[model samples]
Target: MLNFPLWKKLMVGVVLVWSVLAALPNVLTPAQMENMPSFMPSKTINLGLDLQGGAHLVLQVDMETALKQSYEKMEDDVRAALRDRSSGTRINYRGLRSNTETGIHFTVLNPADVPTVKEKLHSALTGVFVLNEGTNIAVAYTPEELTKMRKHALEQTLEILRMRVDEFGVSEPLIQRQGDDRVIIELPGVTDVSRAKDIIGRTAQLTFHLVDESARAGHRLPAGTGVFYELIKDEAGTVLDKVPYFLVKRPALTGENLNNASSAFDQYGNPVVSITFDSRGTRKFGDMTKENVGRRMAIVLDGNVYSAPVLREPILGGKAQISGNFTVTEANDLSTVLRAGALPAPISIIEERTVGPSLGADSIEAGRIAVVYGFIAVLILMAIFYGGFGMAANVALLFNVALILSVMTFLGATLTLPGIAGIVLTIGMAVDANVLIFERIREETQRGLSPMLAIDTGFRSAFLTILDANITTLIAAVVMFGMGSGPIKGFALTLSVGILASMFTAILVTRWQILAWLMRARPKTLKA
Candidate 1:
């Protein structure tokens, strides 16, 4: 009744065989797969964290500090932009320099030099901080006017975190910004989770400060501040080099200015990081290089200097390349950091989870035991009761398993401990459609029909019942999927796919096989 073309049959068989062969590598030991060619398809099921020995962490990024840093940067920008226009007038911030209700009210001095001071104020504040020329000019900012400026620092910090994640090279990584100021990172298979934590945990924020030219020649750093530099040591542990505390000299150089950064070979064919900056950044950078031609400008992050080089001349053209004593990996990582920009906030690992390989093995064993026994009992009962039809049902059951694996592999889905239980449940349900079909066939034969006709009748009548039962089960599985988190989702996914595959194999494939048998024998009486 449902004969397939010879070519179609060959194609189907080939697909099934190739899929199994392709997947075989995944099922084999890692060492075996490694020995095989890279083009070979992997067959092994990807284990979830519960099965794989790995780490899980829930981190909280500090947004408040990020906000303060952003505000401070704006404050500094305003000061310097104004100071650069100095006719050198003395001014003091009056009480309540800013009240920031409907607008920002910054009270300042220089009553006599109103026009010149207003010109300087106009350069930095612009439309946001308008002046009211009185005994002391009061500048006020409009509501929500500085929102974009406020978010700059935090946004930069978040960008840096994304770059760091890329550097770690974890597959199928999940890094996302959580509520307001937090970030969530889920690495499925990680060996050294603590190392990752250490790298990301560092704020890596860099700042530049001029020598405080107003202070005395022999002046020491103020109480709150101290000079910092990289304390590099040789084998004897002697201080071999020092890079300074500043990330960049004087004016701020935000990571946002960077357009492209990549690792490539220099003229000597050594690894180097090439960088390109935006128009505005190129000008600022050129000015900085032009001034500090002989001094070492520190390339610092999280208080440690990565490099400090003396400028030979102004690095113009908005383009430059950094060549350092680094391997290819190091150069690439630095380039990635430059590419990701910066984070919006400082992030710290607050909670961590590490599942040992031993524990994972135990979990797998326990799951396997539960699934094996659960299906074995049901399979045994089916064979004892239904004879030939029962064997057909077992075939369908195997098909269900194959299809489930195929679907999972196609999706690149992870298998968890609960997911194994779902498979076992599927094995039991695989027989349900067969049982219904065979029982209906028995009833049709009792109604005075020949064996072939009765078998046909059984399938037609029982199809609806099989569909209804599977659909109901599917609904339940969907509900479970909704309720579950990571592991639960795995189980629900497997169960749902198994149910669909079971319907096709049990109702259609087995029905067609039985029809072929009935056509050949042309029996007068039904076997059941």
Candidate 2:
């Protein structure tokens, strides 16, 4: 234990130098970092919502709207099933409609067609119960199926919310499900609260519907057409007028087939949203445009028509562009939401809070003060009690902190207020191993052992004890990180990193320092 290899010493030196350099960015101002070389270690620890101050939102998912949408899709499927003639002759149907309360209901014109219709519906629709009374048929989702759909909707909403937040480019965002129908979002460093809310709440449900040219907007004589309005808004987003459009109820294409979307400039240098569809979407869109060469296809988003462009030719390659009189920000936001995909259901913000930068500054100051004072107190106490060896321990403690910061920065971990508390706690615990080893050395010295043998025996004896204590605490930290949410996880992460760093410093670093000193000084009696 007393013998130190040259390679071990070199390894220790490399680690210390790397840690100091990696942790340097935290101490430097942004302007100073900019002045430094580009290849230098410039990444810093990310601050959490509590440390940086941003938007806090609690959103409520509208499950009823989701159910209604599902029923509408089911109604469409049922209509197509009755019309399908591949198996046999098409069965005639009438008065087909769907609602959340009554599900989907339609009547078969021929009583003899009921059995065939039932068979086709059963084969087409899975997880639904179908019943028929004479010529009337009612279809509803099973209880298990409803539960499954709700679960799936909630999960998809969470995933889409995460994707939207990631695209917004906020750092260290905390997005998690709060309850069955609620989502909690924390966006750190986000200044535009209204814009964030708008982006998050917009459903971005995109669909393409063929325009009904013969049907007027105000006069509704068409059976399978609906009146949709296109809002003409200025750059400030205030609607000036709403031009009504008569479009087919069933969409020819939906955003589900979209592969990618981006904001780009048109031929005239105007901002537009360009979209590409997947292979499935490419085939369907090609067929639709081929069938309706002279008709207009309206791009509807969230019940509003954005554009109604005429199909001059069959568009191939699955690419299309939406040109609206939009500002660059609006176009970018629309492309972002489209690329992130639409929310399965509508969500409303039930609660919202904006955290001020001043509060974050105060919290950071408070945490810094606590860490500095606590660290200084520990250093002073160790030096006063153990003399030269205590000073070595204090040096090791500093390196331990550097290691923790470097590791956190490398892992891109978020630093919260509780994380600071963990660091403070680590500062005190870092010296425990040195204290134990020093006490053991004192006992060995009293037994008249040589200084070198006493130091060696002390470290060896205390090694197992130090390892056992730190390992248990490390396990607890891992458990906390795995089981706890948001703030608790942050605390646990810092604590876990601190434990590993402290072990490296207390056992290896301080031991190396003491051994090097003894080899040079050749002390006859230990001062520790």
Candidate 3:
């Protein structure tokens, strides 16, 4: 155990140098890091939400709106099924409508076509039950199917929220489902709460519809049409007025066909959003514009019309731009949401909290003081009890702390208050292995063995005990990390890394130093 080869010494030297270099960035300022040499380590540990202060939000998903939209889509499918000419027969229908409570309802105009209509609808739609009383029919989702839909919607919303948060460049965000209908989000280092909320909460549902030029605002809207308003905003984004437009109820295209979106500037130096569509959307948009060359097309997002430009010529390149006199920030936000994809359901913020940086600063200071005091006490105790060997243990303990910080920086782990507590505990535990080995060596020396033989026998005997103890603690840390929440996870992560580092420094490093000293001094008597 005391044999130290040239390769082993080189390996230890490299690890010590690399760890110190990596941990150096934690004490340097951002300006100093920027001026650092090109070949040095520069990454630092990330701070948790509690340590850095940020935004906390609880959002509730609007399941009712999601169900209503699902029903409306089913209603359109029913109409298309009845109008299908593949069978060389069209079923006449009337009073076709849909609601969340009643599902889709319609009546066949002719009693003879009731059977044909039911057959066509049953074959066209899946996961739905069709029922009829005489010529009147009702279609609704099965209970099992409804449950699956709700679960899928919630899961999809959670994934989309994660993507949006990632694009926002948050360092260590915590996002998870809270209950059946709510989500909890914590964004670390986010100061602009309003902007974060806007990016997260907006549904960003985009649709395209044709304008009804013949209908006026004061008159009744024509059949198969709906009234939508466009909000006119001032320079500061305050709503100035709303212009109402009559648009076709059925959309020509939706955002599901979008390929990419980005913020850009128009020819007049105004901010805009440029969007590209997939092949399917390109074909549909080209056909719609070609068929209605002289009409106006309205671009709607989240139920409000953003732009309604006249189709003077057909657009066939699968690209379009939306000009809404938006500020640069607004345009960028719109582009981000478009690229992230729309939420399956609308979300409303039910709870919100903003943490200030002052509280974070105070917490950090308190943690630093605790670590320093704990470290100093450990150093004093070890030095007074074991003398030279204790001082060597102290040196190893210092490297152990550096190794912990370097590993965390490399893994991009976030440090919280609980993590600091873990480090303090590690400081006390780091010396336990050295104390055991020293006492074993003293026992062997008292039995009349020589200093070098006593040292080797002590290390060999104590190795198994140290390995067993550290392995059990490491297992507990793994369990905590697997089963605990965000804060507990922070604690477990630091504790686990600290245990591994302590094992290396306490067993390998201290042993190497002691053997090197014995070779130089050639002591006749052992004091440890």
Best by TM-score: 3
Candidate 2 vs. true structure, TM-score: 0.87
Poorest lDDT segment (10 consecutive residues) of candidate 3: 85-94
Candidate 3: deviation at residue 296, Å? 2.6
| Candidate 2: C-alpha lDDT | 0.92
Best by lDDT: 2
Q: Residue 191, candidate 3: how far off, in angstroms?
A: 2.3
Give all candidates' CA lDDT scores.
0.67, 0.92, 0.91
How many clashing residue pairs appear in each of the predictions shown?
Answer: 17, 0, 0
Models, CA RMSD each: 6.2, 3.3, 3.1
Query: For candidate 3, lDDT tens digit of each residue in 74-184?
Result: 988998999997877778888998989879998898999888888988999999999999999999999998898888889999999998998899877989887688898
Candidate 2, residues 1-528, lDDT tens digits: the string is: 887798988988899999999999998999999998888899999998888899999999999999999998988888888889988777988889888987899899989999998899999999999999999999999999999998898899999999999999988798988778999999998889999999999999999999998997457549888899999988788999999899998899999999999999999999999999999999999999999999999999999998999999999889999877978998999999999999999999999989888888899999999999999999999999999999999999999999999999999999999999999999988999899999999999989999999999999999999999999999999999988977899899999999999999988899999998998998999754
Ranking of all predicted structures according to TM-score, beginning with the best and ending with the worst: 3, 2, 1
Error of 3 at 161 (Å): 3.3
Error of 1 at 389 (Å): 0.5
Q: Is candidate 2 or candidate 3 better by TM-score?
A: 3
Error of 1 at 116 (Å): 15
The TM-score of candidate 1 is: 0.72
RMSD in angstroms between candidate 3 and the native structure over all alpha carbons: 3.1
